[model samples]
Target chain A: MKFIIQRDRLVHSVQEVMKAVTSRTTIPILTGIKINTTTEGITLTGSDSDISIQSFIPAEEDGNEIVEVQTSGDIVLNARFFSEIVKKLPMDTVEIEVQTNFQTIIRSGKAEFNLNGLDPEEYPHLPIIEEANLFKLPTDLLKTLIRQTVFAVSTSETRPILTGVNLKVENDELTCIATDSHRLAMRTANIESKINGTYSVVIPGKSLNELSKILDDTNELIEIVITENQVLFKAKNLLFFSRLLEGNYPDTSRLIPTDSKTDVIVKTKELLQAIDRASLLAKENRNNVVKLLTHDGGVIEVSSNTPEVGKVVEEIVAEAIEGEELKISFSAKFVMDALKALEGTDIKISFTGAMRPFVICPLHDDRMLQLILPVRTY
Target chain B: MKFIIQRDRLVHSVQEVMKAVTSRTTIPILTGIKINTTTEGITLTGSDSDISIQSFIPAEEDGNEIVEVQTSGDIVLNARFFSEIVKKLPMDTVEIEVQTNFQTIIRSGKAEFNLNGLDPEEYPHLPIIEEANLFKLPTDLLKTLIRQTVFAVSTSETRPILTGVNLKVENDELTCIATDSHRLAMRTANIESKINGTYSVVIPGKSLNELSKILDDTNELIEIVITENQVLFKAKNLLFFSRLLEGNYPDTSRLIPTDSKTDVIVKTKELLQAIDRASLLAKENRNNVVKLLTHDGGVIEVSSNTPEVGKVVEEIVAEAIEGEELKISFSAKFVMDALKALEGTDIKISFTGAMRPFVICPLHDDRMLQLILPVRTY
Candidate 1:
């Protein structure tokens, strides 16, 4: 491949593709990024067996010449060193040329780098999915949906299926759910599509996280193509492919409570800060549990105690309280994560009892809810 | 102990003292911070065998009350947990009280934390250093002197004395020199003192690093007291104590060449960037060597070659070249570090041959100089 490309454009494309490149991959070729140059533009691809990402830079962008190609070819270079070199090159344009014996030369200003390249033909082929069941949504909305639920996915490998987020679409509404048995996060949004029947799939949480990081927070529409064993996300000049987890996701609707014995609406920031301070001492304990108690006059008490370290107690004034008074103990980290995900000024927390799971949602917003199981404390 | 202290003041003092506190200390009490409340102020101390740091928050500073003392006592609390709690406390004023059985209660706003405290008697006593031969220097100058030479200290423990910076005082001039046998960094500054004789000691690089971090960039005079085996630095409300390394430091004066076969003056920043880019590929090799060749014209070539990877060559414009043309290779990392430490718009580099050690100094300043040994390359 022989091409001269703008330094900034090459740096951005290399970074985007590197999201799928794993440093410790068992396959030697997977540690390298494949660069293919054609008459249209230059394409970079990176894969780690689970997911693959490809980024393209056209010859011209916005009436500005981005790349000048002299020949069409393909080669793979070590992603880590190549990315670092590209970032530190001291020139506006970088020239890359591929010679015989897989030798690649990169020149920028007075600095030139020659990196050993591997045969691109040995790299794994990307699986293609049909565009029949494609759905479109704003890139920002998809990023938000991933962020709101990805953290709740099970990090433990004991239950492999639970390590992925379940996506279900019905009647033009798409719902994303992630749970680790102790807590669950659910978010629903409307997507534009013409599917004739309901569609469901489970995507690995790690793939979603990497995708979200590479996706910009723009209003540009992203087309998502889904199949039985694979999924593809297409943006302006990026294509992301992820393998679907082969298993059935557990039904989590029953874990969320439909009625609440106690409900209180409080300013999110105040309650978050109070719980944060109360959890400082509890952090040294194994469970890191903090207790919340509702009292008369719209007062809430948050407390945690560790016999060897110390104990912390905090009293906060709630905006309003309804239903019966209650007390619940749960993981401080779980509650903090849920509160951080539910982006709003005010939040309403509902409790069924002291031992059952409770749900928290943004005030006046019914599209998203976070549920946490309480810990039994003597 | 009973006192109410401002949170910001407490946080700053705790951070300053934490530099001496190590989590993996064998002495249990050494891992805790000793908090002593007196009628005048509150004192916080942390020690880790090699060094001790104490910060005092007086009752008032600049006519603003920083501490309100209700009683006088002392207690030791776990440095790790206490620092975390103090950082996250949600109030401007924090109330601390010690009750029976070393139980400590810290109250701030509506939140309260009770932590288990150790008996103050178990904590080690601070060593007393006589202030007979005390010297004074600006805090900023001291910090700069430390930064200029500390990076050259040997990190390997094979020769323990090489891991320290040698400080020699003669004729009211304090000179600091550090070398790892391959390179040397020396910085000298004049100080006001009442001593009549010369004094010298080796201070651990780690201790100097920590001390410099806590010292702000102000012109405040710092009192430095030198003892036979210990050194004490006292600022307005802070006292830092460090033990001296017990060994003879090697003489580094012979390592810096007196004459040069080739001398070149170049912009510090431009040469630094060129070397940085040339080192990108060289970093993958074990030696990490970059070659510099001076041409008849005012041009210098910087390049590196790795057979398996590729090669990079760059020609840079030198401000002036007055000596014989020569070619030399050296560790890119060492050259970059020396360049980073030298502060000036231009630098003068003198080379005595292809193999002899060279010297680098600021264009017009003689306070600091860096010497580097060139690597022999085929």
Candidate 2:
């Protein structure tokens, strides 16, 4: 393969594909990025066992030449070194030439690099998915849905199913839920779908995390294709493929409380910062527990005590307090993470007794909710 | 002890003292920072076994009240926790009160912290240094001198003495030199000293690095006091004391050759970037070696080859080339570091032979020189 491409264009696509290249992969070809040149454009592919990413750069876009192809062929180059070389090159254009034995020569400005390349035939092919089950959604909305729920996924390997986020679509409504047994986060959004079918799948939170970084807040639409064991997300000239977990996700809707003994509406930033300060001393303990107590006159106290370290007490004025007074203890990090994911000036928190789970959501917004199981403090 | 101090002032002093605080220390008191309140001001001190730093915040500075002293006393609190608490406090001014039995209470806004403190008597006392060999230099100059030579200090523990920068004062001239036996960096500056004596000492490179960070580029004079076993640097309200390494420093003056077989002058930035790109492939090997070949027509070729990986070659234009043509190989990182240290637009390189050491200095400045040993490629 012989092609001369714009340095900036090649660098951007290389970085996007490199996200799926894992250094610890058992398959040697998985560690290398596959490069192919055609008459129309150049394609770069990188994959691990769990996820794969492919990006294409067209020869010409918007009346500007992006790539000049001399020949069409394919080769696999070391992803680590190839990206580094392109990033540090001085010229505005880079020329890549592949020989009969897969010897790649890359030249830019006065600098030239001869890299050893592997045969492209050894690289595995990407699995093909049918477009019949594809649905369209805005990239911004998908990114928001992932950010609001992905952090609550279980990080432990004991339960592999809990490591994924359960995504469900029904009646033109899409919902995403993630839980780690101790806490749960759920977000629901309306979709303008014409199809009359329900789809449910569990995607590993790791894949969504990387996908969110690659996506921008543009109003462009992204097509999501789903099958029994694989899912594909296509946007612009990029394709993202991830494997679906092989198990049923736990039903966490029943864990959320319906009634509460006390409810309070407070400024979100104030409450988040107070809990953050309280966690300074609480972090010495394994649970990182912080207690919240509601008092008269709409005052909320956040406190934590570690015997060997110290104790911290913070008071925040709530906008309104109703029902009975209550005290509850929960992980400070979990509460802070939930508050950060929520977007509103004021947040409403409901406590369903000291030992039961409590729910918090943006004030007057029922589309998102976070539930946490309170720890019993003797 | 009871006092109210501005948050900005407290944070600044805490960061200054934190430079001397090491996380792993055999002495428990060394891990804590001592706080002392007097009628005139407030003092904060932190120390490890090798160095100690103390900062004082006066009651008023520049006609602005910085500290309000309600009571006078001393106590030592864990450096790690105190810095965190002060950083997160919301109020502009923080109030600290010490109760009986070494209990400390810190209050800012509606946030309160109760921390356990140790007796101040257990903290080590700062050693007194006589002003017999006192001199003064601009803070900016000292910082520059440290930056130009400190990177050559040996990081390995094989030779403890080589891990320090040798400082010498003779005949109103101050000279600093550092080397790891492979490369040496030397900087010299004239000082208007009142003392007619000579002094030479080796200060730990780690201590100098921290000192450089804390010292700003202000033209204020820094008072340096030298003793048999310790050196004290006093600047304004801050006092920094470091222990001297006990060993004889090697004589590196003989290593710098006076004559050269080949000489080349080139732009510093161009040469640095070329070597940086050459190192991309050279780094695959253990030595990170890059070869430089000076050819006719003032063209310098920088190249590196790794058998299993690939090869890279770069050409840089030289302003002038004279004497015999030379080809020599050296570590890319070492050459780049030396280039970054020297302050000039152009640099002159003098090569003795293929196997001998070479010297590089700024084109117009003779105040600093860097010598690097060439590698054998046969």
Candidate 3:
């Protein structure tokens, strides 16, 4: 590819695409980033088998010439080294030229780099998805949805489907759910979509995390297109594609309790701090379990004990107490994750019994809920 | 031990002492921090055999009462867990009481912790160093001296003594030197020592790094006392002791060249950036060597080549050039480290020939010098 591009613009685009570059050299071609120059602009693509990211730099942006193309061609260069060089280049503009032998030369001010390029034809092509099943959502909302649920996904590979987050879209609501048996997190939001489609696609949690990092918090809308086996997210000048996990997601509707024997309202920050202190001792134990005891007059006690380490007990005043008094023991990590995902100041936690699973939701909202299985602490 | 201490004051002291606590529980006692309460105040100590750190929280400081002691006793508790709990406790004052069996109860507001503590007698004691061989220096100067040379010490355990930095104090000058055979760094500063005692000690680089982090940038004087097998540093209410390396440190005086045929002065920032860019390509090569060629009229060219990765060429204008033009190749990492340690904006580099070791020092001063050996790149 022969093109002259602005240093800042090229650096920004290269960084976004470089996230998908494969670190492992099992397939040597996968370690290189493919660059293509056309009449419209210059495109850079980086991909592994799981996900791919592409960024385009147009010839002109807002009356400022970003890229000037002399010929239409393509080449692949080492992604890691190329990105590092571009970031540290000491100039405002950079010139890139490819020779007939596929040798690429990048020059900026007094610095010049000559790289051995590979033919772009050797690189794998990105799968294209139809726009028929596309939806639009604000970037900030999408980021928030990913942050709330992605951490609850199973990290183990025993059940491959559980490693991905189940994304379901129907009617005018979009719901995202992630569970690892020990805990479950769910978030629901409204988006604009024309066609009525129910997508039960399980996207790998790791891939979703990478995509979230590339999405800025701007007010711009993102277009999401889902195919049978792949999903594509398109922003202003960036394209992100991730392969979907194959298999049926477990039915988690029954896992959440439908009734509660007792319910208590507590401040999120107060409960989080108490749990954090109790966890100091619980972390030494194998299960890392913390007990919550609710007494009369809005008083709740949090305690944890380890035979060899120590024992900790703390009390937090609940906002309101309802029904009979109760005591439950659960993983401190699960409770902490649920509390962090909650946006409201006050949270209502419902307990079925001491041994059964409990539900935690916002004080006034039922759209988002979290469930955690209690541990039997003797 | 029975004492009540301000939460903020106790937390600050505990953090400093916990630096010596061992992460590996091979020696169980070494992982616990010992707290001694007396009529004067409370003293916290943590040790891991190689290094020991003690922080004292007095009864009153600057017209504020920091501790209220009811009795005199001592106990040892798990350093990591105790520090974490104290930091997150929800109270301004913390009350600590020890039972006859060494069961420690720490209470803050509505939170209480019962820890299984060990007798302080079981913990190893720090060596008592006399003030006869003491020297004094500003905390800021001492910190700077440690940072300038400690990074060059050998990290490998093959030669135990090489992993330590050598310190030599004479009548009015103190010098610190560190080398891993491939490169060497030395820094010297003037200090106040009236006794005219000459001493040489090898302190572990890891301990020095931790000590440097705890030392603030202030004009307060730090006292250094050298015992037969240990070195003690006393600053403010903190006391740090480190075991000396047994074997003798190799002499590095001959490594620095006194005369040179070629010398060049360049802006520190410009040279640093050029070296960083050239290193990107050299990183793929075996030795990460970058070559510098000097031409007439203060023009210098930097380049690096990898057989498979490609080559990079960059130029930087030198502030001043003298003597004959020459070309030499050296590890980019060593050059970068040397440039970062320099205090002045402009650095002067001296070279004897293409194969001899070069010296990098600040333009106006010679208090610090870095020597790097060139790689024979054909």
RMSD of 1: 1.7
Ranking by TM-score: 2, 3, 1
List, for all models, the DockQ compared with the true complex: 0.76, 0.86, 0.86
Candidate 3 to truth, TM? 0.97
Q: What root-mean-square deviation over C-alphas does model 2 reach?
A: 1.2
Error of 2 at B1 (Å): 0.8
Tens-digit lDDT track of model 3 for A261-345: 9999999999999998999999967668899999887899999989788899988889998887898899999999999998899
Q: iRMS value of model 2?
A: 0.9
Q: What local lDDT does model 2 show for residue B97?
A: 97
Candidate 2 clashes between residue pairs 3 or more apart in a chain or in different chains:
none
Model 1: how far is A146 from its true place, Å? 1.0
Off by over 4 Å in 2: none
Q: What is model 3's native contact fraction?
A: 0.95
Q: In model 3, where do residues sit more than 4 Å from their true spots? A: none
